[model samples]
Target: MVWTVMPDFEGYDEACSQFIWDLPASYNPAVDFLRKHENSDRVALEQAYPDGRREQYTFRELDELSDRLAVGLADLGVEAGDRVAVVVPQKPQNPITHLANWKLGAVSVPLTVLFGTDALRYRLDDAGVAVAVIDPTVRDDIDAVRDDCPALEHVIEIETNAPAGDVHAFEDVLTAPEHTDIEPYESTPDTDTAILYTSGSTGPPKGVRHSHALWLGRAAAAYNFFDQGLGPEATVWTPADWAWGAALGGTLFATWHHGGTIVGYPASGFEADEAFDLLAEFDVTRSFMPATALRLLMEVEDPTAAYDLAIETFAVGGESLTPEIVDWIAETFDSVTINEFYGQTELNLVVANNSNWFDTRPGSMGKPLPGYDLAILDPDAADRGVAERLPTGELGEIALRPHDRSVFFDEYWHMPEKTAAKEVEGWFVTGDLARQDDDGYVWFKSRKDDVIITSGYRVGPMEVESAILEHPDVVQAGVIGVPDDTRGEIIKAYVEAAEDAPAHETLREAIQSVVREHLAEYEYPREIEFADALPQTTSGKIRRKALQEWDAQGSVDEESP
Candidate 1:
């Protein structure tokens, strides 16, 4: 019943010195995250609806429900290693479906409900999913893609009053006579657990294969970064979709792993007011926030005066935190500990900030977690798996030597070449580029290809975008490299301004000036373009590739040379 990193840590250095990898001999998410707590009276989940309603469930209740669902899935012909797609929002059904899949030793394919027919078909067909458990909202999308995904055998919809289709209802399936007295599948520590797809920022989304071992690595990071430990009284929440590994593993499972409570808002996206309300209403102490969510929260004024919040820990990532945004968090949440963590969806929780153990640095991702061996390496040598370490303060690809394979992903599902390309010598190369300070903190620069080369100088687009975000009128910004006969490539910026700010030459010059002052003068964008909105991914990433394409086609509105 005891957990490591509980109740007290002398300091960050000691935690690292004494910390050891606690990999379990046998692991299954259904057991480690849920079943172990089935006898306890602790609350497991409290999900909220936009229509002013909240539902709470205990670990014991979920254990029994998942057992029934597991039995139903088996009846539907699902077996060990078969993929079961989960396409639902942040309701109890989302976690229940995942638990059922893992209980049956089946691999879960979690797709966001935001996906359309093409997106759904690609993942369903690729993962060879046999059964899909979905929300009524996305049932039509699943129906449209069923023909293309021949492996999809049946669609099970969550109980809703809406007209039922040919598919079976979730509640009806759980009530079957076979639901009782079924034995759960046994699993090893290395048993393949889930296949999570990437954000597809660069190209098509690749399925990332994970095992039961992934939880230990992610939980360890959460333990330290989430203010040393989360106890039974702790209530955790995040604006991130449960489909993302960061939210599911880093937030949901991590909370239940410690017998704590988790709150969920099953909305499609983030709203600043709702974020504060959820935190206040649930008395949420632990929170995992993406940078976009923080940015959205920043738009509001004096939130502490508006909401009765009891937040203690604010763990943030998913993108770079502009200097301004960082300052706003420190000032606004004066009572909360703000820890800025860093990692890609492919391999997360490796590097993070724990302010309770050390001095929190501004604009820096904290030191590597205890079990991880991380370093900055030559990006060019990464594809060949060459372990070449870059000097301190030098920007290079962040790489890790998987001393423990459980903490990292197994491989890109069915993409060995892509997986192999991720390593440098024996180190796993993170596609992200950063510089490590002498004190061992990492400062993220940008993605590998996102570095813009202009007139014999290299520029990180994030630095430019961050600077532009500091402007009073700027709402969103995207930066890219454009081909130029003279400079090889020139830095260009696309900006979305506020209603009060006009798309004029003066506004462009003012934005350019901010960047020049914040970073090197050469790093400022040479060309500025104004638009009503900049292209962004569903996760709030500024799609610079789309910006480049638009620029190439000369379709940018109000472009200024």
Candidate 2:
């Protein structure tokens, strides 16, 4: 299980100083992660259920199952370059479907099970998915949208008592006796492997297309950030939805690319206790969780004391990491640093706090990764092809060099206009607001759409949210701009209090004072509201757009300013 390409570095500086983006012309991730280990009996995946049930699949077994499924799919008219939609939970079947699609040189489209009929149908119609591997639990949702998806010809059901007349049983595809010795499909490294839809915070979800070479490039994040190497007995687990790029690329693809084992669980309704139990039982060495989940885990009484944790490297993404939670993790876990990574669904892992290479600075998203050239550019001037790079300490949109194919996405599926909008000359605008320091550390501010403008002053929600999180009574915080006739737009803060914390005027004033201390007076939240919990996406990112919508409708119950 040796890697074909080895990073030439002993430390962070050496790695970044001499980085190379060498990849083979013809590459298939299935052949690298699964076929290369087909003769070995080492467990590739361990599926743990909330009810304490566990299932282990060796590399050999998974390889054969994927081969059989690939053959069965071919028999059903699925060919190279076809889109195969996978709508399921985080389980063996999800990755199994991914492997099977790659084996056929087909593209895999991962759809979250949380998506309703409209969202599911929109993606299916958008991608022109030819076949779908779906869980029976979402059969009704799929059925409601199937008529609208003209390209969808086959439906494969997983874990069902009875499938519809036109539907194929998933178990039958894996166990089909006629296709046990099928050869894997051959594809070039640049062949598209997967299309992951975004969370649609600003608009409808866009299909992000990544090639096989791009998928293999995820190994850099593993080797540099997670300290994973060939033949390491590392077990990785993440509670993020498989549909999101964070879990799909960070945990599943990265772990397997390094020949490490992956741990999967039912990710629909994730419970902190169950997650901790699985991590302890499996002795997971590398773990990735969203910032929201980490905050929730901290709410549990002495989680590290209750569960025997073997986690050596813990990474978080999808949102800003507060200094308070970072301190809590440092104190709770022995010799573990809460590594932070910054990237979007379009570009995965551009900047990261690799504890193996450099020390982490709390509240910073660290430096740009090797093989990527990142900069903060003026968002207003980007479209005119005059995107000026901002100096250090000035907030602007994050953009990456487009020529770096190893780290950048190919396009937004079938939307060339949208893809063209993201690029300025040779730079791919990330649409995320951030600023860099003289030390080369990138400080994430907020999404360009999430920035607040109040009284001729620009405010980033992350800075204010980070300050609000420092309060002893606050657990989660979300900030947005509400319409104000006087100031044009006023800063509004939504705070989720800690357990047993009183939500009163005194506490609100204290929270406001924290923001006032950290930022300018105009940037401080003028309106404060208390909520039991903030709305979050499936990937655990706070839905600030939802809050903005609520404010637009005047549905928010605001405390006196």
Candidate 3:
């Protein structure tokens, strides 16, 4: 399990200055989040279903289940280094599959249930997954693409009494007569654990292979963001699907790793009222929620007025958020800490805000978490084959030095050329743009490709959208650069207006005024179009590329959601 070295228990600055990573040579993710907690009577998990059914498992029960499943998988010809894919909701099978696979020293490939045929086929085939444990909801999608995946030999459906051709029932596998006798495979900090694909906001998705040390790398940042220390008293939860990296590492693994209780629900759709009910029922102390989920919660005129909430801390990441929304989240709950972090699939949870450490900066992603060396690098230097840091106030690409390999991914799976491109002069370059202030806070801009070139000035869509969202009538905003002969590229905004709000020139001019007042004159949107809704990624990030295509073709983009 995980433990914070807080024996001194002083302030944030002192802890960071004196902090150092103390990692063991050999480590296993399963041992840390599951196996090590064996035979304990403390409850480790809670699954609340929609039908008024509830299931709670103690640490001992989970460890024994993991043991039996490991043996069962071995009997199914699964061996060390095999790739096992998991596609399910927030159900018991999700964690069981991961724990069991790691016990056999296998790699897990998480796939979202919302993916279409092509999206599903590409990842499964690219990773060459041998076995898949999935919920019944996605059976047809997997069956439709099974023949295309040559390496995929077995499918274990979660709970289907009918047992179709070439598929094994999950219950049958777990109930087989083999006792829990197999020893967990020995693993080190360098042993492979998982392969999470990039969201591909700009291009096709690639598999990012990571080692078991991922949990170690995320420990400090998560601990600080969760308000410093967690123990059996902590109960954490999140609405994100199990397929996403933020939930898998930050919530599911981090909670158990810290000897805390984790709560989940098999929700097909996230109803804001239901979400609040679950939180109140479980007395969840901490959570990692996306900005989109928070926006939906805003629908409730008053949350505490409707339900009792025991939320202590909420960590937001996996998408961009407006400063207004972050502030609203804080004021909505009494005595709740809201922290925003910045990271992608390659390097997860490196930068974050710790309210106890320092006050929340409205628009800035806080200083680097302990154990990381972060910098703002010149975007053009990478193309010229060197890594150079930019001036403190100048905008540049955010990059991380390889000070410790435990926290970084090993490589992009099976793509050596692409992997090589990720590093330049010993720094793992993140293509997102940002700037550091004299106070050491980093403010996010836009993606490198999402930057707009207007006349001789460069602008980030994030800054513009944050300004536009300040208007009371605007519920959502997405900014992009469209082609213009006079200025080369003119800023455009796609907005979702409130029901009572007018979508005429009056509202457009008002939004433009807000942008002009908040940022430089050239950064305001030249044109605005109001839509019923904006297309977004599964994690709640606005798909600006989709907005660009929609503006180009003058129609909705059906290819991505």
* Local accuracy by lDDT, each model: 0.81, 0.81, 0.83
Q: Model 1, range 30-88, lDDT digits (tens) per residue?
A: 88777665456678888889998878898888888898899888888889999999998
Best by TM-score: 3
Q: Native-vs-model 2 lDDT?
A: 0.81
Q: Residue by residue across 450-516, what tens digits does model 2's lDDT show?
A: 8788888888888888888888788788899988998989989888887778656888999889988
Per residue, candidate 3 scores C-alpha lDDT tens digits across 1-561 of 244332343666776677776666778777787656544778889989999999999877787788888887888999999999999888888888899999899999998887877888899999999999988888888999999999998899987876788899887778453588767779987889999998877888889999888877665567778886566788988999888888888778877877788897978887889999999999999988887687778778888888888898888886665676667777787878888888778886888877878878878888887767888999999766689899999999999864577678889989899889888888889898999999889999889888899998999998898888788888789999999999999999998888889756889999999999999999999999888889876666788888988998886554443
Sort the candidates on TM-score, descending order: 3, 1, 2
After the best TM-score superposition of candidate 1, give how far the Cα of residue 213 lies from its true spot, in angstroms.
1.1
The collision pairs in model 3 are none
The local distance difference test score of model 3 is 0.83
Deviation from native of the Cα of residue 432 in model 1, angstroms: 1.9
TM-score of each: 0.95, 0.94, 0.95
RMSD of 1: 2.7
Clashes by residue pair, model 1: 385-424, 385-425, 386-424, 386-425
* Comparing 1 and 3 on lDDT, the stronger one: 3
